[model samples]
Target: MTTVRLPLFPLNSVLFPGLVLPLNVFEERYRAMMRELLKTPEGEPRRFAVVAIRDGHEVASTAPGMPDPTAVPELGPTAGFGADPARAFHGVGCVADAATIRERSGGAFEVLATGTRRVRLLSVDATGPFLTAELELLPEEPGDGSGALSEGVLRAFRQYQKRLAGARERTLSPGTDLPDEPSVVSYLVAAAMMLDIPTKQRLLQAPDTASRLRDELRLLRSETAIIRHLPSLPAAELTRGPTSMN
Candidate 1:
């Protein structure tokens, strides 16, 4: 297999292809990295790899060098998020392309990236300002009937949408047309529904669509069942649209 080296983004959330993620670039190194990446070929992979930071926020100071800082916690049945040798989660990831950029009030940069394909993490050479690593491209699986969710999941999804619609003060429910397959349904559901960062990252790290859907289905079921007792809506509700959310 061909090997590729890419700049690293160790985030609290997982990214998937055909998905959009927003990144806040405030660190000097990552801001510099962004400037450099902006100069690269656009139509090419425009590739970058992401790993979860186990115990630190900034990689320059906190992330340890050799043993890969213990292992990132796995949210699925397997250690999906912590698989990448260069990172916490290795096998699954989105090869994203920079889509848009905006400057925030505090001089931080906000960027939108659309995930293009999945890549496998092989090794890392953490000798630079940001993390860099060798990556193995993973073959895309033709999602057939893998982890299909039950009708209860669907019903919960609908209520989740309604709750989100009410929170955003917008009647929009684009995700209401979610496909039957577990993968598509899960991503769409997670994208539209309000969930915690760690939970969402877990969904991102799920090995297959079926697993992702199952995890999301569980979360939705729990949330729907406890909606009445929730103290407040998800703090993420303030910004909850595709372009606006992340």
Candidate 2:
């Protein structure tokens, strides 16, 4: 596996390969990161690792360079996040390269990052302008049952969607129309789900495509069962998507 020292941005969400993470970057450290990223000879990559924050607030108000501290708005809750920032990051995270940038009127800017591959974070260096990490590529384990596995995952996923629509008592997108490759399908569905960090991280760290598919099937089955029994569930609660805040 290859290793590279890359900038790390911690978020409250988990990203899977093939997913797109849209972010609003206002923190000073991340702003400096963007400046350094665009300065390579041919232009350094707009790539970085988006790790899930374990315990700390998304941004510490008192971090260096702060103008003034304000009351942090209450986020709904912190689920699946760990307790220690040092060892809190999920070991496996997606490598994302900025696909688009929209500078806002304020100092904050919007960025679209497309997830590529999983990387294992070896160590983190926080002394830089932004968090930097020694990341090694985490390759998926190739398995033989891709054909059967993909079909199974797709079937279960479809049924889950249908059941979800029933629970919502409304029409929803009936299809994800995912790719045929098992690994891609696995990541796509994992991205589509509204899972917490630990679950997403576990799926990302699944040893092989088949294992990931199986785990997804179980999750779909369990969720579908709940949908079937419940009187109703809010569409917002049951529905899942790829886009998330950073």
Candidate 3:
């Protein structure tokens, strides 16, 4: 595996390739990382890996701790996620390169980054305060081009978009016009905007375009069905902020 050291950001949101994510770099370690990157020659990639934090929060809480459990269950199921946070994440993750970084009114930076490729998270270090990792590049498949999206698939996506639009209108009229080229980027942005962070992460980790599209089509259809069946469902239920990727 090819390994590179990366400065990491732990956030509640997930980022996807071809999508934009704005970061407020207030922390001292991250600001230092950004300054180091900015000084580098243009076109030199200042790449980093994104990973979901298994531990609850970086800053430990001082609130009164809860008492230990009274008793372990007699026949508990095999240990799951909570059993071992350390072993939770697969080696897989995305490698993103900075597109833009601007200093905000405050001392922090307002940065925009776009995903360029996928990387495997080989190991991580919290040697300092912020997270850092060692990652390996994940090679793209042979047919990574947009050609796999058949005419039938495109038509289905168009239909899905239409339904999605209708659903949006019923709630608050979000203005996400369907793109002319329903390209892979388009699908990625759509999935990024429409789904939650965990769901979007799943989409990013999907092996190929076909599987990602299938999952998005399924989600869009499901949301449309929900709107159709429960027309009375609160519009608030359907409201989600636009993805930074857009």
Candidate 4:
């Protein structure tokens, strides 16, 4: 049960390991986070934990003249630690490695990162410029029959992609080749599907590779069937990948 402390970034979408995450960081709190991360010497991994905000608690930009959206509420002196700030975020998240953090003209940052590994949130601290948390690094386990499951998921995923293309009248991946590894297949399918946040979060929290692939298999078949019956889909509905936010 190895644990590490890192800055936290809560987004409206779920992040799966091995997926690219591009962010438009414009908020003051996140600008400060970028500055802190920049202090790290170059050539080292600049990392942060990205957790999905729970339903009804979406992070939004503060309106002009309004209080800072990232500010922690001032609890009374008698307020106990039992008041969990982590409640606003899902328990499972992915650690992102920032490969490029470019400071913009207005002190904001443009970050290009990739999800490296999964983690479990232990606790969150908000009494700082930005949120930080203690995370327990989760291991990638290839569970029972994951190899077989991967084959099934890949087949279903191809069908799913074809159905999606037919519904939207555009090829989803063009000529992009799918991977063969079980764990990679699971994460790729999880990220590529147009599922809801809770479903993707559940896939991220699955106990092992086989479990994630199993869920993806079910989802691909179900979603493909639904898509096959649909007359057409809106272009917006065909959008995939992480939701880029500022």
| Candidate number of the best TM-score | 4
- The parts of candidate 1 lying over 4 Å away from their true place are 1-3, 55-92, 101-109, 140-154, 164-182, 196-198, 231-246
Model 4: residues with Cα > 4 Å off, grouped in runs:
61-83, 167-176, 233-243
Candidate 1 C-alpha lDDT tens digits along 1-246: 866788766654556666677776765555556766767776754557665544333222332222122222222111122333343543445566777666677755778887765676777654555556677766544244444463445677766645644454443355545566555556667656666556666666666666666677788877766765655465356345433221
Evaluate residue 81 in candidate 2 and report its C-alpha lDDT on the 0 to 100 scale: 25
Tell me how far the alpha carbon of residue 196 in candidate 4 is from the true structure, in angstroms, after superposition.
0.6
TM-score of 1: 0.66
Q: Which is the better candidate, 2 or 4, if ranked by lDDT?
A: 4
- C-alpha positional error of residue 119 in candidate 1 after TM-score superposition, expressed in Å: 2.9
The residue-by-residue lDDT of candidate 4 on 1-246, one tens digit each, is: 899999988777889899999988876777778899989887889999999877765345423223334443353211222356588789999999999999989776889999999999998887787779999999999999999999899888767877776644554453557788999989988988898899999999999999999989899888988988876655444445544674
| Model number with the top lDDT | 4
Reference-based lDDT, residue 159, model 4: 73
Candidate 2: where are CA atoms >4 Å away?
40-44, 55-85, 167-176, 231-246
Please give each candidate's TM-score: 0.66, 0.80, 0.66, 0.86
Instruction: Write the candidate numbers in order of decreasing TM-score.
Output: 4, 2, 3, 1
Compared with the true structure, the alpha-carbon lDDT of candidate 2 equals: 0.70
Provide the clashing-pair count of each candidate structure: 5, 1, 2, 0
RMSD in Å for all candidates:
8.2, 5.9, 8.8, 4.2
Estimate, for each residue in 1-246, the C-alpha lDDT of model 2 and write its tens digit.
699888887666778888878776665666667666666446545789987755454343323334223212221112122233448677878899887766677666678888888898898775555678899998887577877988888888777766766644443444544588888989987876657777887888898888999899999888888878856545554444434433
